[model samples]
Target: MTLLEWPASPGFPEPLWYWVEDWHRLLLWATDQAVSDVTLQANQPVVVERHGRLFPVTRRRLAPAEVYHLTQVIYGDNAPSQLAGGQDIDCSYEIPRGRADLARYRVNMTAVRAGRERGVEITVRTIATTPPPLATLDLPPALRAGLVFEQGLVLITGPTGSGKTTLLAAIIRHLLEDPHAHRKILTYEAPIEYVYDFVPRVHASIAQHEIGVHLPSFAAGVRNSLRRKPMVILVGEARDAETITAVVDAAMTGHLVYTTSHTNSVPETLRRLVSAFPADGRDGRLADLLEALQTIVTQRLVRTTDGRRAAVREYLRFTPDLKDAILAQPPARVVAATRHLVREHGRPLTADLDALREAGRIDEREYRLFRGLGTQADAISLPLPAGPDAPEPGEADGPG
Candidate 1:
């Protein structure tokens, strides 16, 4: 057994590494030692990063007996009998041995087969993370451009890990920097992320509340926000009918509101928000929602040439034409119409990618991969605002 040590800063913990260069043995060891509650990965090899350095680990298949023995190492000698009758089970434990330690990983183990072999594989990921920012996130310029609106709805949509919370934090920070924002800002998040330490909003008193931990859910957060008399309300997700209805009413009644969904595009965000209500709420409600909706931004982050990640954004600003389209109820046309507005009012994700390429900020392959359904910056294409519609480049803002 060999031990690898990482040099950590005075306030950080050192990374412990155990490299079994033999990939088969490494997989067997990982499978045996994985603890429940930790995320496990399959096919992909074990990768660990500490400080600024990454540790390389290998992966391979595991035999039942090897898994059993590994389980014994992780759970005690009796693990073999406990897992003997099961093919699918979730179990996890930590084994601390010397400097090469394992305690932080919450592992999920499952059964899989490659070709003719019925073997078990473990996929692993870390559970330790700082709570995601609730107010700031990566946002597209098109959606975030007119963020100063006093009363409207801004919507963000994506699956988890699409960085919705990060975008929200960026938005809050943008407003905090503005001297004109003198009203109170309140946010409701599930396990709030991005605690504001230093913001210059003189008139805005920012308050953050955690759902489940503080309130019941997002619906409750929205209802309570009305009582707070806030100028801006940030709902973590307008997921349910009550929350969507509340957010719509808030926007209509003149308090700007922001929220997120699990949809893909801007038009879909509109459809989803309206359809979330029953038939009663669906009647002419979408038009109202659209009228209050100032912007809907869809964005994703991709790896750049520098080995860091960069955001690409698709922008959609509310115009009289868009409001009319939503009232027509064939909301699907929204995407088609957005292409024109994207060209005219907001620059698309491809425009930013091209600009980054021209400036030598990103590479050709990187730009091409993130081009998405939009135009690349041409000689005539207006430049996209770097980061959120902020004053400089590389800044961030939330979609909602």
Candidate 2:
């Protein structure tokens, strides 16, 4: 699809194709998050580059007839103009940022149906997102470094909007920054959310392919990376049997593969992946999965009193004991085992929540909800050291 070369609206700061910040502002002026997920894709006329990324700014409004004209102008006579009278229209359009110009924003366009009549509104979601740094992951040092070095299936398990993609991005960025490690990184993402910022390598090339835009699914992307001669492969999310099989296969082939799932706990993540196979292929695939399994980290976002949010996380670093249990296909003991070890020095989510509560990093109610505790229960543990180094309650490091 091609974004059109429309005349820049004279009001904005830069000549624009489209931008989410614009939409966010316009939505506040328009109806405040009333727009649907479908949108017209385009490029901004302005070039704003930050840390190796060009953030393209674009905008759109409910002009169905103007959209038809715009599409025909960009796509010529072969455009889907005929579909206008057909009720609901779905397609992508782009403006050729005047040739020799590399587009930072690849706008995706689709029409949302509003009953009998369809109003064309262009919604631009993140085609590529540059996430925060790896050091900011706040992970245990063991998990932060050990996860990338292992040549197995390391999974970050979390529900939607739980920072799984950001975690994966941090891990990939960690690998990319190591000087001696020259590995081709291949990624397959549904909509390709997180974009890497800091990559340091002369020969290391990272290839990211989107699900609908590049290949069909995560399975296809994983299989394709095998032929691309990759050292590191990242699958955005392994939510199905096909994707799970492809990721496991990629790991088993002596490649460092990373993927994620929507499980709240380590054992649950293992069981979810293993059980993705049919009842017939369950045992064999379970063994293969266990053999390739490296680590699982579960994450959740909790709000502080000031309205800012932070990631309270837990990790199950794949050890001999854990791997043995997984290989045996008895997954119930994984969380119990992880909790036991993390209490010593390793960080568990419960422990983190308790710590946050005790330090007033999070209040008792917020901490309890995150700990899966009700309002009536006291989830905060008043644990601290006794020396001058000991921080006071409701304070973590710098004063709250």
Candidate 3:
């Protein structure tokens, strides 16, 4: 059908049973509506989240069999078997948008307890086809400077859905465009959210490998990248000790490495990575991590007065002096020491949020929400003075 002549699909039709093409059309419609997430469940109407609100887009609740068929259509025939084995499947799905572009989604399918019986629920997060330029992100000078290091570990960290992947993608796109950077970049992602096909590789070349589809794991991907002579490696997540160890090894061996983690701030990022190793070897691992550390950026997306979201970032660049200070501390004292260095040489998230509040970019309620999102331990761990709106210990706060 011609673009203009195509049927207008705001929601699903009356039919409870949908074809694979029907689901694709519905997703395209949701994308056009600026929906950020789509949810499908066994006994619920198809729902979409747009502008931070959720609403049903289908007239009828989907049957269990229909949901099963839809999973097969998006994921594959093995999705049912995989979900049956008690493993939630995380993968990427794509549909052609036109002759050259594709629309992509990060998909997760799991078996949910539906009124005492098992049923399926699928969550799909929409991703941009093209990565934005790094300049457009308006990262602070300190954070931007850390991105150019020849060889070290640069971590982009935050809670889930806090724009960590988007930020990392922009950094990779920046590297790919630099005329002086003529480096070979390799990326290991679970589902490969962003594709660099449209970005002109002016000097650097990149190859992206999906964890389950190509390599078996992130650790394996890092090890494999070494054999292929990559100058830069981007790892999707460094959650396990093996992957974290591999990341540190790659950095110490002179390959620039970029990775992400689920963390709240700079001090927490260091603690999480260092604590990943066994206690007997943690001191050595912490020393290696410190030696190879370049930067740690923790980001949070908060609502602005304009009704859109803005990123408030806290970051630390580990200069030689800062690294030495951290290394001098005992293992039990490293986190506290890092917090001290962050205040001395880096920008803290509270400071950024306060500036945004003063400039009227965000409302006071939004400010308080993000300001108090850190854990009680995080609040106690860092030695920085508390913001005016800092929450009490163990007090609940909104998502970061």
Best by lDDT: 3
Writing each residue's lDDT as its tens digit, candidate 3 over 331-397 gives: 5556656666777778778887888998999888888788864322233553433653443333222
Estimated TM-score for each candidate? 0.60, 0.65, 0.89
Instruction: Write one digit per residue (lDDT tens) for candidate 2, span 238-258.
Output: 989998989988898889999
* Number of colliding residue pairs in model 1: 27
Model 1 C-alpha lDDT per residue in residues 263-338, reported as the tens digit of each score: 6556446556766766655656666677688877766665555444566665677877756653543333443444
Q: Scored by CA lDDT, what does every candidate get?
A: 0.57, 0.59, 0.83
Residue 140 CA error for candidate 1 (Å)? 8.6
Assess candidate 1 and give its TM-score to the true structure. 0.60
Off by over 4 Å in 3: 1-15, 374-400
Number of backbone-clashing residue pairs for each candidate, in the order shown: 27, 21, 0
TM-score ranking from best candidate downward: 3, 2, 1
Please estimate how well model 3 matches the true structure, expressed as its whole-model Cα lDDT: 0.83
- Candidate 3 matches the true fold with a TM-score of 0.89
lDDT of 2 at 116: 60
Instruction: In candidate 3, list every pair of residues with a backbone clash.
Output: none
For model 1, what is the error of residue 13's alpha carbon versus the real structure, in angstroms, after optimal superposition?
Answer: 9.8
